[model samples]
Target: MAAAYEELDRDSFAALTLDRLARRSGVHVSTIRRRWRTVEGVVVELLAERSSMLPTPDTGDFRRDLTQLTQAIADFNNALRNRNVLQGLLAAAAHDPRVEEIVRAAFVRRIEEVTLIARQAVERGEIPEDTDPREVIAALAAPLYYRVLILRGSIDERLVHTTVETTYQATVAGVFVRKESREGNRKGDREG
Candidate 1:
């Protein structure tokens, strides 16, 4: 069903019904319903499975690991079919609340996975202990999204490196870390 969905554009995906999926997959609607509960359930699970496959690099060097992850995503987005599907989904998400939920949920899931890098970095003293992992993950991903979706620009080599370095610089400068949290960490260190 997920592979079936991948072959579709936004409209086609939105048009998919349990019967259509059942017919296409050779599974009965009752089976799909019993297993997935709803169309949204199947799609959301598909999105989760899709994102879970995204690389989570851990080289013990936060910068390198982040660079690898971002670069891998960029490279994936560089492919025409994948990019078209993503763009179509983004466009579809605008009007459909169900689609929007799936898109946002998938993003949050990816954020949760990627944020582990930022958390690990704290233990390594690469990022501040008070740094918000979500913020760091956003910084790493935002520029590529902007380039692809907004500017319609190339997700090129330089853009990839710059995104990684800029996120790293901002992180070390405590841009993603709350000021009060950083202060509290300092206080704890001093007291200890």
Candidate 2:
């Protein structure tokens, strides 16, 4: 399946068929159908498999960790095939509920895995304890996604530097503190 995907251009990927995949993979169409149900399902599974290879960096320094994470993201997005797979999957997700569910669950799992960096940063006293790991990670990644998925732009070193530095600064400044923490602080202020 990956071979089939590799042979096709980004535009052709969206139109990929089970028969084409079966021919490329030498698996029966029935087997492919039974396993993945649809082309989008197969692609999403491939995405889950491929994206898991991205390491969650833990350099014990938050800034270094963020830099590693950003570089990994930039490297992943720089690959035309990875970008094609993501574009195909997201386009499918918009129209297909089952694909959407699978994609969403996969992303949630990845996010949970990657948020460990922020959790470690908190443990290392690099960021406020009240910082929300998910929010911090999201801020770090959102611009990259916007650049690749929305603007169809290439990943550049400058973008990686800006994203890492911005996220790191905001995190250390308590910008990503949990809402519960913010509310508690507000209550304390009122009482004081």
Candidate 3:
């Protein structure tokens, strides 16, 4: 099925059929139909499968960790197959509630998995104790997605470097510190 997607243009996912997928995967059409029901369903599953391949770095240095994570994201988006899978699923999610739900769930899972990187940075005293891990990760990733999905551009080394550097600077400056933390800090400042 992935091969079939790779063989076509990025926007050709809509033309995909169960028969094509079955032939590509060497699975019976009945089995494919019973399992996935539709090409969108199969793509949703592929998104889940491929998105999970990103590795969370535990290099113990916050900057290094961010660099590694950003590079991993770059590598993932750099692949035509993975990018097509994401592009197809996201385009489908715009009109299909089921696809939207699955896509959202898949991203939420990835966020949760990568949040540990930020949490570890906190433990190492590299970031603020009250830093919101989710926000941190989101800040780090939003630009890459924008470049790929919005700009329809490819990931380059310069973007990766800027992403890591900016996110790291913002995080260290308490840009992603939780609202509660910000409020408390303000209160403490006033009292002092």
Highest lDDT model number:
2
Query: Compared with the true structure, what per-residue lDDT tens digits does model 2 show for residues 1-192?
Result: 575566454445666888888877788999999988888878887788878999999888999999999999899878887888888888998998988898889988988899999999888888997787888888988999999989999889999999999999999999988766666754432212
Question: Please, what are the lDDT tens digits per residue for candidate 1 over residues 23-115?
Answer: 778888899999988766676666566667787999999989988998888977776545655666676678678888888978987898888
Residues 1-192, model 3: lDDT tens digits: 564555444446766778777777788989988978888888887777777777889988998988999999898888877787788788889988998999999898899899998999999899997888888889999999999999999989999999999999999999988775677755433212
Candidate 2 RMSD computed on C-alpha atoms after optimal superposition onto the true structure: 3.7
Worst 10 residues of 2 by lDDT: 183-192
Q: How close is candidate 1 to the true structure, as a TM-score?
A: 0.76
Clashing pairs in 1: none
Off by over 4 Å in 2: 8-11, 185-192
Which candidate wins on TM-score? 2
Model 1 bad stretches (over 4 Å): 5-44, 183-192
CA-lDDT, candidates in order: 0.78, 0.84, 0.83
Clashing pairs in 3: none
